[model samples]
Target chain A: MRADMIPLAFRDPVHDSQSAFRRLLRALSRPGTPVSLPGPAEAPEPMGGPLAAIALTLADADCPIWLDPALSTERVRRYLHFHTNAPQLADPRAAAIALIGDAGWLPGLNGFHPGDAPYPDRSTTLILQLPALTGGSTVRLSGPGIETTTSLAPLGLPNWFWPAWHENAARYPLGVDIFLTDDRAVVGLPRSTNVEVP
Target chain B: MGIDLAFDDHGVYSFAYLDEMTKRMIRRAILKAVAVPGYQVPFGSREMPLPPGWGTGGLQVTASLLGREDMLKVIDQGADDTTNAISIRRFFARVAGVATTERTGEATVIQTRHRIPERALTEDQIIVFQQPQPEPLRRFIPHEVVARKLHAFAQYGVMYVRLYEDISRLGHVAMSSDYPVIVNGRYLASPSPIPKFDNPKLHRSRALALFGAGRERRIHAIPPFTDVKSLDFVDHPFTVQHFESCCSLCGAQDSYLDEILLDDGGRRAFVCSDTAYCAEQRGERTKS
Candidate 1:
């Protein structure tokens, strides 16, 4: 697709980003709960509305973002660069935020930065665009944000995802946080949450 | 020196005072803070009109979160009409043009210093705390490097030792405010300077709690339904302050109270520290 065909960014930058951030906050603060996200009306192929909205809301000139192979298309990169001005890094470990188009082809979680002992906040925040928020194998989540055990069944994840997530949670304050998104909604699974797969 | 026309203009400040970039930076920090639950995320703290010891941190957090639709409420020591509370409220009103309210229930975002409102906050509401010091280990270990390492390893045995020392000295925990708590069974966090009575409210709260310390250049958070356990010994459990005397005017036994000197003849009266709660109680009494 031509550069001209790339979709426009948020109509109202200030209010739209604020609204999107609030929704993201709500989703992350309540693990496994799917929350509606306000994204641009249209997005490039493979990239959905919620993913684009999150990218626009978070990515900026100061933030370094890494795009997965599936989402490394010219149209998507041009769209993100035109709007956010965030530098696309070659290494996922160095990027502050990583965008993954296909969850089934997720590169192992160990490759990404798990931050350090002192500054755990330096870790990357992965935004994975999945097929859907639900209708898959279920997993139980408990910890911060959850009053009791809550379950999530986001579709399109690999069979090894839950085991890898358990390993991620074991790192405690050092693991990368995740935001699972479909076309219109998002669900956060922070490192603090314990994901149990039966 | 001649004043520039742009500087002299009344509405020169951007919406909610901070620039969009700054807001974005702070917002990112806030998200990380929420994800970590209690771990402090350092940010670029900007200079506000208010002094550092005041509510500048809380002001910045509130400013970052504020929108045209939000209803803001500012309080100092549980009173909405106090000088600090009123000034901050008016500041937001002038800068952001958002509606300000004294009622806790009506507020979407509540900026507070040293107190959580007596009324319970709902799921939709958020509480921004003005934290003088965000690190709970600061008192125990003055060295920042060592404290960071201790936090990294989840080594909180020092804090328990301190509490034990207090118990040995005073026969009970002598801390009156600014108590240390374990957030989500992970990092140790300082819940601002709210009294022991308000400490229990932090546990599994329905509303999100965001803490900001401007001078400290740190931001932290406690998400809704998260565990916040105050430090204490197993045999001598943690307890809130109890008042033998209820409010003098509203007669509320459950609310935190403040003592007022009625005269120089050693006479004093106790009243509810939360002025809004006191007024509401009085209104209910009058109706009945």
Candidate 2:
């Protein structure tokens, strides 16, 4: 595809990105709660609107992103490159943000950077694109953001996902944080959250 | 939608005073900080017009988070009319053209130094704290390398020993302000220099709390409803300051008070440290 054929980013960059970031922040702060990203409806194949909005808001030249095989298409690459100018890295460990199009083939959570002891902020933030936000296996989540306990049943995750998430939570301050997104909404699963599979 | 490449009409400064890249950097750090509650995330701290130690950290964080629709409120030592508070409020208003509020409930974002507002904050509101020091273990262990290792291992004996030493030397825990707390039952964090009276407010707060230390180049956070336990011995539980006297102006007994010296003859009056809360109380009394 030609460079000009790539879809455009936010029309009002300053205000739009700020709004998107605020929504993302709200989603992350309140773990297990789904928040909607209202802007930028257009995206490449396999990349949902919410995920695209998140990428436009956060990914920049400074941040290195890794795309899973399903999302590693030439069209998506050109779109992200045209908008964010963020480098796409082959190594998932080196990526600050990893876009996962297919959850079934996702590697172990330990394969990615859990971050160093002193600086856990250096860890990767995984943005997984799911078919829908809910109606799957139920899991109880409790941690910093949760007042009591909240239940989430994100659809389209692999059978090994929850167990791998348990291992990720075990690392505490050293594990990668995750954002589960559908086409319209996102739910955050921070490292501090404890997931109990019932 | 085609990208609008037009420059922002908000005068010489960018939308919120900080450049887009800088805001993105701080925003990323803030997200990491929130993900790992109480853990300090180092970022490229920018050079604000205001000097260091004067709420520069909080200013940057607020700048990054502020939108045109946001209602900003700034307080210094809980007073809304103070020099620092007024200056910051004015700065944002000029740069971002956002609305400014003195009422705690009316504001969406509240930037504070040394105190949390007396009024309770809701889930919609966010609190930005100005931190001079982000590290709770800095005083106990001067070496950064050793402190990092200790945090990595979750060995917080030094902090407990410090409290023990305080109990041994004095009859009670001597720390009046900036008491250390364990966030999410993991990392030990400094709750800025807020008085012990305000320390309890940090526990399971409904509002998201973000702390920024400019000179230290660190940002940390405590998400809403997070576990923030103040350090204490099992036998001797944690306690807050008690005030026998109420606010002279509004007669608010539950609120934190500031002792004001009226004259050189040693006449003192206790008033609410939170000016807005006191004023609101006075207004309510008049209405009733």
Interface Cα root-mean-square deviation for all models = 0.9, 0.8
* Model 1 score (lDDT): 0.91
Badly placed stretches (over 4 Å) of model 2 are A1-4, B1-9, B284-288
Q: Could you give the C-alpha RMSD of every candidate to the true structure, in order shown?
A: 2.7, 4.0
User: How close to the true structure is residue A97 of candidate 2, measured as C-alpha lDDT?
Assistant: 96
lDDT of 1 by residue, B1-288 (tens): 986767433267788899888888999999999989899999999999999989888989999999889999998999988999999998888888888888888899999999999999999999999999999889879999999999999999999999999899999998889989999888999999999899999999999999999999999999999999999988989998999999999999999999999988989999989888898888742111
- DockQ per candidate, 2 decimals: 0.77, 0.83
Candidates' lDDT values, in order?
0.91, 0.91
lDDT of 2 by residue, B194-248 (tens): 9999999999999999999999999999999998999999887999999989999
Q: What's the distance in Å from true for residue A107, model 2?
A: 2.9
What is the CA-based DockQ of model 2?
0.83
Models 1 onward score TM values of 0.95, 0.96
lDDT of 2 at A70: 92
